[model samples]
Target: MKILLPVDGSECALRAVDHLIAHAAWYREVPEIHLLHVHPPIPIGRVQAHVGEDTLKAYYLEESQASLLAAQQKLDAAGRFHTTHIHVGQPAEIIAKMAKDLGCDLIVMGTHGRGAVAGLVMGSVANRLLHSAPCPVMLVR
Candidate 1:
């Protein structure tokens, strides 16, 4: 089984990683893990106009690397093998697409666990993923 784990370097996100590591032995064999970090695109107005394409790319790379670091360290400590991917886009859309493109059997992620009103006001990527992701989505709070 292949599992796509989307992380944003939040404490909530790391909980998802921990949840996966804790439950890994339940599977028939170790699952193939894909660690994905999506960076929100810089607005097209001033930031893009001011920064070179290569510089923007580097910025995204740097941010994604920072966001992925803790998750990677935890996985490494657990002796879990995973491949990392970085992208720049809306998180929910990027995550769903990556899960499908990678042919993932499941998506594991963490949620802020907001109430419906708060979620509606703030927007919930986990909720969006639950509805849009091609595979089953497991959310860790």
Candidate 2:
């Protein structure tokens, strides 16, 4: 199975990594893993114009690296290797798109476990992924 794992470097996100590590043996074979971190697009008019494309791209790379580091460390400590993907866009949309592009059977990610009202107010990525992901989504709270 190919699993798409979205990580944000938060404590809640780490729960998803832990879940994968704890339950990996349940599968018939070791799953192929893909770790994804999505960053919001750079401001096109002001920031990009001032910073230039290369600098903005560098910033995105730096931020994405910071976000993926913890997840990478956790997976490495568990002895699971994974491919890394960094995308620039809305988190929910990017995550869903990456899952399909990677031909993944499942998307495993963390949820903040916000209440429905809170989710509505906060606009949760998990809620969006649940509705839009191409494959089944497993959320670790």
Candidate 3:
């Protein structure tokens, strides 16, 4: 099975990795894990101001890479077969798109993320993926 694991370097997100590691043998075969980190979009106004477009883009890439690295470390420690991706967009949208694009059978992610009021207002990544994902979704709380 192919499993898409969306993470934001949050403890809650890492919990999903922990859950997968603890339950690896439940699946009939060793699953291929896709670890995804979606970076927040750069502000358009800032891109036109003090920060050049290239610089802002570089910043986003760098941040996303860092997040991916952290996630890789966790997955590595767990001895799982996985690949990392860094995307720039809304987390929920990017996650859903990536899962569809990659033809993943399922998504394993955290229910609560880093956002405060926004997460509560618009719903968390897990909630959005649960309602919108094309495949099955497993939320780790």
lDDT accuracy of residue 67 in candidate 3? 65
Clashing pairs in 2: none
Pairs of residues at least 3 apart in sequence or in different chains that clash in candidate 3: none
Error of 2 at 116 (Å): 16
lDDT of 3 by residue, 1-141 (tens): 999998877777878888988999999999999988888776687557788878877898888777667668877987887988888898888898999999999898878777553465433677777778989988887
**Model 1, range 1-141, lDDT digits (tens) per residue?**
999999988888899999999999878989999999988888878887788989989999998999999999999999999999999998889999999999999999987522233374333888777789999988887
Query: 96, model 2: CA deviation in Å?
Result: 0.9
Per-residue C-alpha lDDT of model 2 across residues 67-94, encoded as one tens digit per residue: 8998999999999989999999988899
Off by more than 4 A, model 3: 118-123
TM-score of each: 0.92, 0.91, 0.89
lDDT of each: 0.88, 0.86, 0.82
Model 2 spans with C-alpha error above 4 angstroms: 113-123
TM-score: which is higher, 1 or 2? 1
Q: Which regions of candidate 1 fall more than 4 Å away from where they truly are?
A: 113-123
lDDT (Cα, 0-100) at 108 in candidate 1 = 90
Residue-pair clashes per prediction, in order, are 0, 0, 0
